[model samples]
Target: MDGSAYGDIVAQPNWTRSTHDSKWAGYLKSSAPDNTSRRLAVYRGSPLYSRLDHHTMSRAQLLKLALPLVKTHGFTREALSRSVLYLPGTPHAEPLSETAISALFGDGDNARRTLLDAWLDDARTDMKSAPSPIMKDVLASRLRRNEPILRWLPEAFGLLISPPSGVPPLDPSPALKHVASIADEACHIVGDTSLGLSWYARRASVAAVYGAAELHQLASPATAYEFLESLLSSSSNIENTLVNTEAYAKYIGRSWAGIIKSSGVF
Candidate 1:
């Protein structure tokens, strides 16, 4: 098929590489498992094909032209997520709503710094008391989506654990204390983390809940609540024991709690 036809198919929100053959085989035959060859053929035929020449245009300029076409075609969140993970230097048709354009371009460098600062400020404000419930809910909501904060957590931890130049030194003890308080509150909502566990086990129970929520994004559109439910339902005795022992809560209390605590120098 020609570039226009291919572009039309790709523009659809639900379009996948598999969709090309299953849905639009009349225009193009399935040449390979992936539609890479077909996509290249279409690109070669499109007006933008000439612009691929590095000397002819800058990467930013190409993205400026291509983004409109991508949006016009109806780019989906699933496609954008995959592109962010798989296509590094390549320009995406659209940015993920939770991610900043600058962060996406720099692969979370800017985002990590921004979030770390925010977390520090928030933690300091609540150093003497538990973090506000509203703040906990806000964090939980962001963790559920494919947002920049979730994506940048590992890097943020890296910085917190071993701060680079100009990055301030941090003491994670206050953050841990706050996390423990939130976790204890969450336990009260679910069942009880203090029932049969030691003090360390109780702390670990809280850590587990936060860890589960942070990882929930990896399983996306499926929420952290659903994932926790599934884990609770697991047949394995150990799995069941962990959730039950921890008193798995409906909502993650302070999703960044365990992360901030665990990334300390100690």
Candidate 2:
């Protein structure tokens, strides 16, 4: 991992003191030093880890650990509004609003677009006062890397898209139309779906190169936006395309639900 990337993961106050670290320490003390041993130790120690362990614990042990953590550390509106990150500007910092967080975590089709636009808008504003072209990209990169709820957005999106039990069936046309409109708007905001692809691909590639723990952060968004682009670019009739897309989307959505349920929100 690059120094800055590693710093991003460890920079938060008391991150080293998190329970995750304590568990790692315990595992290392009990196990021999080797590649497989190290990997097993880390995996066994991770709070995000999930598996069935009959003798030591039981099924869904990780879920049990995560549920209580979520309840205890749940995000608050005031706390979110107060969050800030340094950027290239006279003030050298940008404050993210609770509304932005809500929109990103909200159930609406436009939520992703809103979240991306807000971050890009701030980056553009910072770029105007930036001393160099490299600084502009730096600002944008930092914004994405340090984005609040980066770990939770996918789970939130998963929950949002999940079908609610007992809801009556309604016309699919309007919902499909709304999704199309949101896709157009997102493309407009970012210039094109190609640019969105580039943006996500860059993040994913960098994270992979750096061996970042949160690969899903990039994967989930890339999958979702690409799916949207595919829907728009398909030449098939709207009804047919919507039918197939809905099925595919539901499948992907269920995968995310399983991920969330297994891994829990961070």
Candidate 3:
């Protein structure tokens, strides 16, 4: 696997840290198939990943695989956001998306949008429990991107976030608004502001990226470049580091990619 894959794998929910490194070694041994490869191929005479491949993994599995990834590596909130953005459609994902979830999120979609938007609008918040380590030059690399993500707008941003799956298709932006409403109520249901903030920040970061990228759909090339340049140049201006990095990096990348309907400019 390449760096990105390795980075992602270590972050997978299946991974866990033991009190001893030997546990990891044992896991490595157990995960392996025969003497050929560690990759699990046929579980009970079928492709081991068949369910995951078909986007059939349940929500229980999704959370298990994804949460640990976030916690272990402290994966960026953007990464966390992406994970949740696609949760509704993930294989085996529970019916977490509910309308009663956010029915009280104001009357209109815009109001719901605003409610959802605020969950992670600020950068100072620590959105994820497992925070990714400060990657070498990742911040700088993001700031330096020649263009932001291809095409995105804040409203359409949810589409860019989440694991790739085909379980179901949703109108991601509205779904996000709904999800945010659900999330908001869920937090209140639990009565924890900090926990709510933590829950939404990562999810919001993912939307912000998609929303920012969606703007490219309306922006001219020069406009997009200038927007990205300004974002990068003004990093010091933003009080929040996480927000700034995400807006400039993952979101920007997604926005740049959105324009081309791909993942990146290259």
Report RMSD (Å) for each prediction in the order shown: 19.6, 23.7, 20.9
Greater-lDDT candidate between 1 and 2: 1
lDDT of 1 by residue, 133-161 (tens): 43344335434322433444454455544
* Model 2 Cα RMSD, 1 decimal: 23.7
Q: After superposing candidate 1 on the true structure, give the runs of residues whose Cα lies further than 4 Å from its correct spot.
A: 1-117, 120-148, 163-185, 188-199, 218-223, 232-266
Query: What is the lDDT for 213 in model 1?
Result: 60
lDDT of 3 by residue, 19-137 (tens): 22123223222211132122112221342333223232322222322332332222223223233333322332332233322332222243223222322221101121113322112
Best by TM-score: 1
lDDT of 2 by residue, 1-266 (tens): 23432332233222223344334323322111123334444656664334322222211121122222222232233223222221111121544455654543343333333333232222222332333333223233333432444555444334334434424433344333333333333333334333433444333332232222223334653443334334333422543554566679889999999999889675
- lDDT of residue 179 for candidate 2: 32
The global Cα lDDT (0 to 1) of model 3 is 0.33
Better of 2 and 3 by TM-score: 3
Q: Estimate each model's TM-score.
A: 0.29, 0.21, 0.21
Q: What's the candidate order when arranged by decreasing TM-score?
A: 1, 3, 2
**Candidate 1 global TM-score:** 0.29
Runs in model 2 deviating more than 4 A are: 1-147, 162-182, 190-266
The C-alpha local distance difference test score for the whole of candidate 2 amounts to 0.35
Least well predicted 10-residue stretch by lDDT in candidate 2: 58-67
